[model samples]
Target: MKIEILLDIKNRLGEGPLWDAESERLYWIDSLGCVAYRCTHDGREIRAWDLPDAIGSMAIRKDGNGAVVALRRGFHFLDFRTGDVDLIVDPEPDKPNNRLNDGKVDRRGRFIAGSMDTSEEGKNSGLYRLDPDLTLHKLDDGIIVSNGPCWSPDSKTFYFTDSWSGEIWAYDYDLETGNVSNRRTFTRLDTSTGGAADGSTVDAEGFVWNAQVYDGKLIRYAPDGTVDRVINMPVKKITSVMFGGPNLDVLYVTSMAIRHLPRFPHDPVERGALFAVRDLGVRGVPESRFGA
Candidate 1:
């Protein structure tokens, strides 16, 4: 297929585009701007909220109340009605250089998030899971930039990325026990041309659609580690992707304008933008919300 530029906010660092099925709105975050935004399917009705700190990612609540947010300092609850914020847990209070990055609620409503080092690169970061009861568990360690963290349609497999390593890994997931095993390489990037995989989402057919940062494209991959399709993009740094629209035929993508500063200086069109492509007709499972 073909990709179209739907909304070009010129976002400094736009990430985490989640489709709110009940409201028919797309929610995303501008990490550097520390703002969360909501818009319609056609890219209208823009609404934004200023967060106290940089927001890594967010998820809708099970009861349709508000959202559980992973912020730079810690995790909190965002009230959709009153706009009230409540802190849940802070995993890295001592490591000031580290900040929360990408996160999502599993099938069981447990929020799993990853952290990245804001200072130096390399594997100084780790992945943590926030249970429904608000307890935190360290799932993996020695990661530099943690991204993706999306689950398969059956909830029996998890796909996550380590951007620094340029590798996407799959883990055998135990839905009941919330445990992951059998860590193996799913895919690796060609560092010469493609940027590392950032955020990703799985479709109903078990294909993983990932946003290839610096590559200016979105890739669909089969379960056995094969490239299914690639949709070219205008911008270099694509941050994330999600399947949305009425029948989920439309795919919404978020991109970053961070690393293209000096080279493409003064070029305004390619910054933080929301993109859309049609005809996939793949429905994504509703995002899990946090609640009792």
Candidate 2:
């Protein structure tokens, strides 16, 4: 399969790659640069928005108007038509040292997001859930850097990663109560080698795909936590991965130059651009909408 750059916008720290199947477009955020982009899958018809604050991730709304985004301070509803940001509750009003990070919509349409400690020295951040009715819930605590959060095919299990701990954990998820418990380790990585789990997604076949940032590795883990496949990325900071394209066979991988190998074919230009792996031979389930 040929890997190609999908966009040359070059983000400072490109994370959150999401495909809005309804519009046939891809949405992503440059976490450190305070910007977000909407583009054609082929890198054409691009539109960039300069956000007032840095955004970690966003969840597409069921109506397709815009998204519910996680910002430096809190979550807000970004209206594409008027460029307005409607305030949502800030779960951590007193914790100024924490910043929002990776997030995704749940099967029930609640926006589940997590925060990270700015200094990376304190475990002050945790996972949060933003209900469609505008209520907020703290799902977990004692986390330094929260990354991946995707559900099992049956919606009975949830997988989350603490990037700093280099471990991915699983929880028995309850849809009716929006609760997760029975936390246990699903997989672990050696951050001692400077690699940790980042953003992740699930395929229709029930496999979990995660990008190991700062280590240039993509691992496909079986439901029981066995390594199924390993993909060597061109850049070290492979922040996130998601399945897109018409048939959902294209794997859109986001990268950053925050860390890198000694030399690669595309050095500086690969700094924070999005890349695509075509005909990956797998398809992903459609993303759940924010207020579905």
Candidate with best lDDT: 2
Residue 261 accuracy (lDDT) in model 1: 38
* Model 1 lDDT at residue 90: 88
Q: Rate the local accuracy (lDDT) of all candidates.
A: 0.83, 0.86
Error of 2 at 188 (Å): 1.4
Per-residue C-alpha lDDT of model 2 across residues 143-181, encoded as one tens digit per residue: 998898999888998999888787899999999888989
Superposed by TM-score, candidate 2 places the C-alpha of residue 204 at a distance from the truth, in angstroms, of: 0.8
Report the C-alpha displacement of residue 155, candidate 2, in angstroms.
Answer: 0.9
Backbone clash count, each prediction separately: 1, 0
Clashes of 1: 1
Candidate closest to the true structure, highest TM-score: 2
Clashing pairs in 1: 11-272
lDDT by residue for model 1 over 61-92, one digit each (tens)? 87777888889988988887777888988898
